[model samples]
Target chain A: MNKASSALSGLYLLLILFFLYIPIIVMMIMSFNRSELYLLPFEFDLVWYQQLAQNDQLIGAARNSIVIALVNTVIATTLGTLTALCFARYEFRGKRVLQGMLVPTLTMPWLITGTAMLMFFFWSGIGRGLHSILLGHVALSLPYVVIIVGARLRSLGVSMEEAAATLGANGWQTFWRVTAPLMAPGIVAAALFAFAISFDQFVISYFLAPVGTSTLPVQIYSAIRKGFTPEINAISTIIILASMVLMIGFARFSKFGGER
Target chain B: MTSSARRLRAIIGLSGPTALWLTVTVVLPLAAMLVFSFLTVVPVGGREAAFTLKHYTDFFTRPLYLTNAWRSVRLGLEVTFFCALIGYPAAYILAKAIKGRWREALLLLIVLPFWSNSLVRTFSWTMVLSDNGLLARTIHGILPFAPSFDLLYTYPAIVIGLVQSYLPYMILTCYISLQAIEDSLTEAAYSLGASRFDVFRRVILPLSLPGLIAGSVLTFVPVLGAFMEPRILGGQQAIMLGTLIENQFTASFNWPLGAALGFIMLAIVLLIMGLFYPVLKKHISVN
Candidate 1:
């Protein structure tokens, strides 16, 4: 009976995984199909991918997305790492309140946060465009970086830095020589997370994108709303692959879903 | 300089940029949204504006907004219920039934897609659920006499898409909490003559309730504000509070009304979180 139940549980999980992956797999397969109408008896073809390469608007949007995500990664990681260091090393008045500030972006729906950013940016003359989108992306990615790197810092437990100081190294020497090198893997992981967050971000980009220009996601959203084409599937397949690759890198460095 | 003063300076120097960035991008914007919700107009382009409660009042007076608001709540509850139902068992199997390397690999696999582009994943559903899509094609291939059907542009399609999108959150949270349950406690229950069902019901379930609650909140709040999935899958049937607020901003160009609707949704989210705070505090440490 126990063996039967265990097997049933395994089968149940298989079904769930199948459900999770089927739509994504079907989407990828259809991207390679020759038919624009998504008809069956799928003749595998590279026509859609070739067409996607020629699409100037999508190509431009993709360029914009890459640029924004890269910039967002650098800025959010640096600032967030610094803040994580602050939280790790200090016990200050209003520290809890300061940390509480990060909760809104983490917990609140992006719809609310996106619309709020839209209103404020437009009103404050930040105006909608790549700049505003970058700002929003950094804000969204910052908390994740802090949380991930902070966990790493906490695990390091300050002992190494303390030992360095006891050996007559100043704060600068200790941080550069000991702390930074030790924190390298966590920083790399957090930077990858920041990139993925910015790259995969759609809602904020959608709201903040200026007229006639957009990030890849915002562009994809418009295309989906207008109509689906095999070209969309091609771009989506590429996007999913890119995001998964980035996340895999993050998982490797962070030991995500591994032995704690 | 005094040691305390130097420490203060270090804290400011390290944290200032992030604090400033969040203020301009998140804190200030949310504050502006609150102020916008009370305005007579968007207060742009030299348009004279006055404070008014009409937008908030409009939500109460308009049956359409109220009904859609309730629909959004209903959608949240349904999605949360389904996620918990589907995720708990999978989490349990991963946490308890499975062992070692396989458990780690399966957990990673489950979390992988969740980190990928949600927009692309949501769009993927259209291919499988649309009329003459893959599911219909497969069914027809197997049984030529079967009737053709599509699940797209329906409430159930929305539910299905959302459940898939959010299920990993439930699984991850439940798995974390469940893994913390000691094997010895369950062994004790068994040795004390508790049946398998009794042990699960009275022991395992209670121990895992915190994760379940945390996962439910994480799932429910976003589902409450979901727009993209419903738009892609539910078509005209997708007019929940999310889409309604989206229309005010994107189509109607009514910023005030959009802000008001957004706040009402935020209020509901906060109310739910407040209610769950005591339970959440005991089990989850989000940071």
Candidate 2:
């Protein structure tokens, strides 16, 4: 009875994985198919990818996406790590409330956040463009960086920093020599996560992106809305692979699935 | 400097940038949106705007707005229900039935796609669900007599795409909580002559409720405010509070109405969270 039930549950898990992955797998497969119409006698070709290469709008948007994501990673990870440091080391008044402030951005739907940003940026003269997109992306990403790196910080405790201080190291010197190196893996993982959050972001980019400026996801959104093209499939497949690889690296560093 | 004074400086210095960033990006924007929702017109281009409760009142008086708001809430509940229904069992298997290395690997595989581009993933559903797309083609190939049917551009399509989009959240949350339930407890129950159904009902379900609630909140809130999925997949049937708000900004250029609609949506989300607060407090320790 036990063996039979276990086997049945295993089969169920496989089915769930299949459901989760089928659309993505189908998308990746369709990207390589030669037929523009997605008609399948299963002819394979790279024609769409070749066309994608020549697509300037998409290329420009992809460039904007990378630049914004890169900048967002640096800004969010630094600020978030510092805040996590404070949360870890200090006992301050209103610390809980300060931590609670992070929840709104994390939990509040991006649509509301996006529209609110749109209104504020427009009214406040920040205007809509690549810069506004960056502003929104960094806000959405900061909390995640804090949460992830903070998890790492909590695990490390104040022992190492306290040890350095006991050994007569100054604050800056201890941070530079000790804390920085120890936090490196978590920081890298957090940075990668921030990048993914920004790179894959759509709604905020959608609302904040002005006419003639867009991110890759924003551009891809418009492309899909304009109609389906196999070119989108090629780019999307590439994006999925890139993001998956990044997350796998994150898992390795963060021990995301937990230590064996 | 005194140690306490030095610590104060450090605290301010470390957290200041993030505080300012959130103020500019989140707190102020939300405040501005609230103000905008009350304004008579966009407070720009020399337009003289006055405070009015009309936008909030309009939600009560306008049937179209009311219908869409209802639709958005219903969509949230439906999607949340389906995600739980599908995700809980999968999480159960992963947490309990599976063991060790296989469990870790499978869990990673489940979460891997979720971190990727959601917009791209949503778009991918089109290829599989469109009338002449993969599913249909495969169906006809196997059974020539079957009528070609498209699941695309329908309510069910939006649900399917969203369920696929958010399923990992449910599984991941449920898995975390479920795995924390020690095997010894269930074994003890079994040895005490509890039936499989009884154990699940009395112990497992109650213990996993927090993950289930957390997952529901995670799934429901976004799906409630989702415009993109409905736009891409629902087509003509895409009108919801989300798309309505999008239209106010994008098409109608009615910022005030959109702002009002956005707050109403926020309120609904808060109401759900408030209702679930007691359970959430007891189970989930999100910091």
Provide the lDDT at B142 for model 2: 97
Clashing pairs in 2: none
What tens digits encode model 2's per-residue C-alpha lDDT throughout B125-219?
98889999878888998999998799999999999999988999899999989988988999999999999999999999998988999899889
The sequence of per-residue lDDT tens digits that candidate 1 reaches over residues B7-42 is 999999988898899899998999999999999998
All candidates: CA RMSD (Å) = 1.4, 1.5
Which model scores highest in lDDT?
1
lDDT of 1 by residue, A55-169 (tens): 9999999999999999999999999999999998888876776677787888788999999999999999999999999999999998889888998998889889999999999
Local lDDT at B140 for model 1: 89
- For residues A1-260, could you state the per-residue lDDT of candidate 2 as single tens digits? 39898888988888988988999999898889998888767888999999999999999999999999999999999999999888888888967766766777777889999999999999999999999999999998888888888888878888999999999999899999999898999999999999999999999999999998899998999888887678999999999999999999989889886767
DockQ of each: 0.75, 0.76
TM-score of 1: 0.98
